[model samples]
Target: MALMTKLKHVDLLADGSLRYRRRIPLVAQEAVGKKVFQQRLQSKEGADLIKEYAEIESLYEQMVAQRLVRARKEALWGNTPRETFKAAKVSSESVWEGVRGLDRDDPEDRHLVAASLKDEGVKKLILNPNKTEPKPTLKDALKLYRKERVKDDAAMETRITRVWSEVEEAIGDLPLDELKRENARKVRDHMISVEKYGGGNRSAATVKRMLNVVKAVVSFGLVEFDLGDKTNPFIGLKVDDQGDREDTKRLPLPDDLTERLRASLRGDLAHIMTILDETGARVGEIVGLEGADLFLDHETPYIHIRPNTTRRLKTDSSNRMVPLTDAAQKSFKAALKEAETGGPIWPQYSRPRGSDSASAALMKNLRKLTKDRKFTIHSLRHRFKDRCRDVGMPKNIQDQLLGHSSVDVGERVYGSPEAKLRLAAQWIEKLT
Candidate 1:
């Protein structure tokens, strides 16, 4: 605001020329990286010099604003100027200012300018015009999602990775924002072209799971990048589940089959099946047990189902103690001899995809043992529930024993592991 003559911050030089000068705001001095802006004016003529002075002053105003915006962004998001633009975190005004200085003849600059002009939000994404990296693609989205969602379930990891890889291949790894509804449809159609999971052409259920993988990644990326929810191209996507008509529902193992399999199984599978049937624990939970997880010497013999290096529990509630049945105790004692003291009880099936490998092997045998497809290894878990419910066990206690979240949160989550184990032992002992 220093005015020597008629114009503000315009200094009349000793050599009879006009100079444009101004001190930067105190708060913004560090961000601007200078105490003041001083420029020797090129125009010495009457009205031209005044116009030149005005233009120089306006440019400095913009420079200060741009620098302050960058400082705020760095403070808030910890991103530098170039990273802010790349991440779509820069303001439109800042982007426009940065792009304004670029030479349009340069191919790189021309592309950025063209892209900004073409976009509805003008200059919004033109942060660093000199450095335009590839757009974030679907595969990138999946990689980021997997990194955040840590899971030791090797089977699911393998399955989901393949599902996303198939989508990426079908869609040529399209950028997340560039992914269209048609691209999702194409992926859905491509997945349904096979009959792998079930007999007779591909199932509608199969296509839905495939599409869900795409939806999950896209949704996760949109949120992670602070893109609006509606921007997720895969939202509201639908896949028809009207094909194949096959009964995929699992049925509880009949009492006769349960007894026969229990008696028939020997070695590790016998012990595993015993634990699965006796305590409604999932197969992954059973196979993940290290010798340390078993508390046989305690007053209430039990096994702790928890997250370990080899496997992650399905949910936080999955970490609990389940009292062992007499059959389960005997089986654990036998299985313990297979490992090195407190090491993994089932070493062969205790690593990534180990539980999956075990499941596939057990399922092959299970398929041979039963005529019905519904009576798979998982049916043993159902039989355990049926047995628990049949013996008049409280639904809350049943949910605790099964590692399932319950409607009665107090009953399911409000006890010491010992107290819970004692209660579980009392009810589970009632089971045959």
Candidate 2:
């Protein structure tokens, strides 16, 4: 009797050759254990009969070639039959062993190397597999960061780009995630020690700016990892005069100095500076004025201070009217006389012609006249607030004249039409 009972024929392709196979049933463990087994045959005649019908080892070379073409088509469309075959052979040494024995210079063998790595699960090997490397080529980082910020906030995006550029220049080959606090501190210290400015050594301000970049990236990383309540390493880090950086030094110039500075200035620069000193309007609002902003004919001459470039106002409160002083009214009248168009009242002080020309000819001219003075052109704005206080201008009226929103009274009840009229009237009376 034969214990070997042959089952249905199966087919397989090997090296562009096809061959048939047959299975003999056995217990699973024994099948796994045995390379070959002895079988008790029914008779010698039966054994011989089974061998005769087995077709020896017939190879279908043509069928195997056709199957290769079909498999290639499937692979191109992402079915990837070849990869599946390699994956299915993970436990089998002979399949990959044969792959290794191929010509070392062959491109196909290089692909086989990649497949080998994939088969071993290379993705599970890294500490921060999902996190991107800082060493991503400059081109790649730009594309990724740009794609991330679609809102086109130019100021914010510029800062991010600038910081990345600094980091890239400092460390060329290292990835961003590999950066440590020690290295970041080194960079900060280097910037503080080595960097130069218009003054002496680069101030703590410059150091703080560079550290801010490192902190931003780390914070972004922490958020990505869902880490809770992590403090940034850059937070407590300090350079020289660190406490002094917090002091904004916002105070008014003395009355005598303010008057001298005003008289020393000429043209739009003089007028603009004068108006800023009188009204406490921001430089942006003063420079961005249009003829329509001034209402000189009204009972109280006033100008609406809006925060806008070419498009629209920045905020609702920024759209309110501010009373103009006598000096401001005189400047506005002079600006109107010189205006070629009604768009911007102060036309001479319009947008820049060029970087060098604008800075040297325009800004430098003003700086030359005020060089001996203690006050900045911006200090005039501070003086306006101080003068308003000196003259016993009500806080609410002063805030209204400065086009500032009423924080004390709250928005709901402040800056009514009556309040605006009263403030504007008081401003006119004082100016007159």
Candidate 3:
């Protein structure tokens, strides 16, 4: 009981170790999820006890600071006073937890404890549980934005997350209101000139997309956090043209390269590439294919492209039945046989937010096949379009086969799926 006699909130167990125990504040009960916070001091000696207590108390203070930041963010997002109080209470408990036990004999320890309390108070004031004027940091903005968007648009979420990661790397967590035009320019320059995005200077298309993602997130944060009146630094920001790299346009794979890819790729990757080459279906579409989506036995053997729980088509025009060529039919049969075990055609790649993962794996395999980075798995679709055009397929028919919105008003508004399918099947037969 020597430790207990010296320190308040410190209990001496039968084995002689000291323990600190305190009840969690009533307001923070929900957030902290505990009636009491307890930590064993793991020391019997007075000096060791004091040192360990200070360390633990410092950690507890840090925890409270974090909770307070969370509470303040909730308030900014329009959480009620009662809800914010829970977080405030947790923070208050953290400060008290740090200063609860005092060694009156040790003046240095007491001074250290007082200084820590002052530091915590300063942090709490800065966080300001009640006020919501100054917007949250770009870091917090990104965090909240991702939470809201990930459910609806995982691809966009991924892109935003990636862009923000680069931004964060270039400049540490900056306040949203403090994100000046200069900061925006720095980020753009960093991405295009300094950062090796995709192993080289970011192409013009990549720079534009990254800037767009940053701008969209900033815009979203302004609206979501009710800071719309604040100037958006990302708006009207320009990235110097890094020349016309044609980054987004996947080049058509030549016949020689196509043959090599077919021979080289194996397993699900091979099947995915084959489907892409023959059907011109997107990698996401093919990877997300289901047994039910395949209509092989029907009059027109085709793969139905539709949004499912796991994957979403890029646009409304993306939803259609692509008539299978003889080669595509063979690939689908092999994929179907594998899918007999149940779930999607490529179950391993069939994740709700997994298009990037699928693309990355395919790219790694592709690097082995060819040195040209432009000739990706997506190039199969471009190659398909080239082949369709070379064989004298009409523009409307080509658009239907590739799931592109037809430019012609009549074809776009009046074209039926069945009619398009017949035209597509005929053109596809020519290629086969």
Q: What is the number of residue pairs that collide in model 3?
A: 0
Q: What are the per-residue Cα lDDT tens digits for candidate 3 across 1-432?
A: 555586656777778677887666665555566677789887667556665664455345444434443443443335333334555556645654566566533655545544655455434532443444334677666667667775557555545655665686677667776778888888888787653322324466678888887887788877777788889988887755535446434588889888886775555567778888888878888888878788888898998899875677888988888898887888878877767544688665565334544565566556777877577767888999999988999998888878888779888888677887887798889898
Output the number of the lDDT-best candidate.
1
TM-scores for all candidates: the values are 0.61, 0.52, 0.67
Please give the distance, in angstroms, between residue 234's alpha carbon in candidate 1 and its true position after superposition.
2.1
Q: Model 2: number of clashes?
A: 6
Question: Once superposed on the true structure, which residue ranges of model 1 sit more than 4 Å away at CA?
Answer: 1-134, 144-160, 189-213, 220-230, 239-246
Alpha-carbon error at 270 in model 1, in Å? Answer: 2.2
Q: Which of 1 and 3 is ahead in lDDT?
A: 1
Highest-TM-score candidate: 3
Cα error, candidate 1, residue 314 (Å):
0.7
Per-residue lDDT of model 2, residues 34-149, tens digit only: 32222222222343434322222111212222233343323222312333333344433334455547643465654555455544432221211243222322223333444564
Candidate 2, residue 361: how far the Cα is off, in Å: 7.8
The C-alpha lDDT values of all candidates are 0.69, 0.50, 0.69
Off by over 4 Å in 2: 1-105, 108-150, 154-174, 182-218, 221-232, 235-251, 297-299, 310-319, 337-342, 345-374, 403-406, 410-412, 415-418
User: Candidate 3's C-alpha lDDT?
Assistant: 0.69
Please count the clashing residue pairs in each candidate, in the order shown.
0, 6, 0
